[model samples]
Target: MVADFDTIDININVGPQHPSTHGVFRMVLTVDGELVRDLDAVVGYLHRGAEKLLENQDYRQGIGIQDRTEYLAQFPAEQSYVMAAEKLGGFVVPERAEYVRVICVELNRIASHFMFMGAYGTDVGVFGTSFIYGFRERERVYRFFEELTGERMMYSYFRVGGLAWEVMDGFEEKARALLQELKRGINDINGLLTRNEIFIARTRHVGEISAERAIEYGLSGPVLRSTGVRWDVRKDEPYSVYDRFDFDVPVGEFGDCYDRYMVRLEEMRQAVRIVEQALDQMPKSGPIMPEKMPRMLRLPAGEVYVPVESARGEYGVYLVSRGGNHPWRCRVKSPCFTNLQALREMTVGEYVADSVVILGSIDLVLSEVDR
Candidate 1:
C-alpha cells in the first residue's frame, strides 16, 4: 500500500518556441509543486552544420558562414575565422586596420550586451519598457554598422589579411557620436531595473553558482565571470591590438543572475573606454589590406587556432589546411554551446518560474549553441 501523502514529480516542458525559450530552445523540467528537481536541455533545433559548410568554402567564402554561426556577435566570429587564415598564411594586417578592427568589435560587444539587457528585462517581467530601452540603443549602433558595412547584421567585412575595404568617410566622428548615445542608453537600463525592488527580489540570490563549480562546468563569458572568475580573452590572452589598450575585466561576487547582469552592465562602460582610446591611437591613413596579396588565397598546410573575446565569451576557431584554397577542417569553440552545458545545474533547485531567468542569464544565441 502507498502512503497517502506520497506524490510523484511532474514533468514540464518549456520552449522550442521563439518567445518563451528565447530561441528554439526546449528544456524538460522535473518539478515537485513549484520547485524544480531536475532539468534536461534540448538543443540542436537550430543547427545549420556550419563546420561542414566551411569545408567547401575558401578562406574568404567561409567568412559568411562564421557570420551566420554567431549571428548576434558576427564580427568576432569573422575575426576568429580571418585570424586563423592570417595565421596560416603569414599575412601582416596593417596598423590602421588593426585599430579599426578593435573599434568595431568593441562596439559590437556593447550592442550584443544591449540585446541581453532588453531580452533579460522581458524574461524578468519588466515587459516592453526594458526591451524598448535596449533596442533603442542597439538600433543606433546597428545603423552605424550598416553605414560602414552596408549590412546591419551579416557583416563579413573582416578579411584574411585585413578588411574587405577601408572604412567609410567620417568613420571616427560617427563612432564617437554613437558612443555618447550608448552611454545614455546604458544609464537608462541601469535606472530602470538595477535598484528596483521587484527586479532585485526576483534575481538577487536566485540561480547562484560557485566559481569552482563554474570552472568545472567549463562556463565562460558573463556566465563564468558572474561566478567571480576574472578572466577575459581580450585581457588574459590579449589577441590583436588589445594589449595596447587598457580596460578592466568585470566580475561578480555572488554568481547569481543579478551578478551576471551587473557584470555585463559594467562591461559596456569598459567597451566604451577601449573605443575612445583606439580612436585617439588610430593611424590617419594606411592600406586596409596587405600589398602583394594573391588574387586567390591558399593557406599552407598547417593547423592553427585563434580565439577572440566575443560578447558571449571566448569564440575560438580551429582551422586545418592541406595547402589548398579550402580548409581541410574547421571547428568552432562556441561559448554558447559550452555555457549551455551548465544550464541544468543552474536551473535545478530553483523555482520553476526562475528557469526562464536562469536561461536568459546565460544570454544564449541558439544558432551558436546549435552550430
Candidate 2:
C-alpha cells in the first residue's frame, strides 16, 4: 500500500546563507515530514562571471582570478591557466621548475584535503576539535607557501613560462619537515573522526552512488573514487612532473559518505609521499623561468586545453588565442560544478539532516561551482 505523501509534503528553503550549505548556496527542499522528497540546488548567488572576466585580462593576470575560483587549491588552478597559456605560446618549462611546481601543487593538495576534513567533521558534529587540528596542519603548509609566494592565499606565483621566481633557499629541508609534521597531523585527525562511533554511524551507507552512476554524472576526485573508480588526473594524464613521482591513488568502495571521507584521508597520505619524492629528486639550483622572456607575452593564434589534477578534481582551462595579447576566450571546467549535479540524486530519499552531511561530503568551494 502506497501512503499518500501529498498531504504532508512541505517546501523549505535551505540556504543562500545557511551555515551548513558551506557557501551562499541555496536549495529548495520538498520534504515529506523528515525525509527529502526532492531538492532543487539553487546556484549563481556567488557568481562573479569568472570566465568572462578571464577573457578580458591578459594571460599573465588571469591566474589571480583562477585562485578565487578554487580558493582552497590555488596551485592547481594556476597550473592549468599557465599551462594553457604556455601551450598556446609554444613555451617549454625547465626541468628544475617542473620539480618545484610539482612539490608546490602536491603540498597545496594536502592543505585542501585538510580543509575537507575539518569542515566535514563539523557537518558530522565533531566541530571545534576537527577544525583546530585541521588548521594546525594547514597553517604549517600555508606558512611555507607564504615564504615562497609572498601571500598566504591567492598567491599568483605561477607564470606562463615557469614560476615567478626560484623557490626559497633550504626549500628541500623545509619540505621534509612539512611532510613529517603533516603525517602526524593526519594521524591525529584520523583518531578524532575515523573510528568515532557517532561519525561512522551517521556517515556510513549514506549518500552512496555507484561507480557507474558517478561516471555518468561526471563526478571526479574523492567523490568518484569513493565509488571504487581509481581515476586520478595526476596518474592517468601525468601533468607537470607527476609522472616521475611514486605514490598510490586512493579509491573507495560503496561510494558512501564514509567512503568519501576515508578516500580523502588516504589521499592526504599519498600527497605527502609525492611531496617527499619531489623534494628528494628536485635539483638544488636552476632557473625558475626560461631565459629573457618577453615583457608582454603575445601568443600565436591557437587553442589549447590544459587539464590538471586539483585537490577538488580535474581543473581544466580551454584557451583560444587569435593572435592577441589576451585570450579570445577562456573557459574553465570547474570540478565542484560538475560534481554538484549529483546533489539531487544523493539527497532524495534521505533524511533532511543527512542532506547537509552529504553536501559537505562533496567538499565544494561554491565560487568554483558558480564560475
Per-prediction TM-score, please? 0.98, 0.98
For each of the candidates, the C-alpha root-mean-square deviation to the true structure, in angstroms, is: 1.9, 1.3
Worst 10 residues of 2 by lDDT: 1-10
In candidate 1, position 336 carries an lDDT of 91
Q: Residues 1-371, candidate 1, lDDT per residue (tens digit)?
A: 23378778999888788495878999999998888999999999999889999999888899999999998899999999999999999999999999999988999999999999999999999988899999999999999999999999999899989999889999999999999999999999999989988889889988999999999988899889989999999999888899999899999999999999999999999999999999999998989999989989988999999988899998999999999899999999999999989988888889998999999999999999999
| lDDT scores in order | 0.92, 0.91
- Candidate 2 local lDDT, 256-332, one digit each (tens): 99999999999999988888888888887878899989989899999999888889888899999998789899999
Per-residue lDDT, model 1, residue 162, is 92
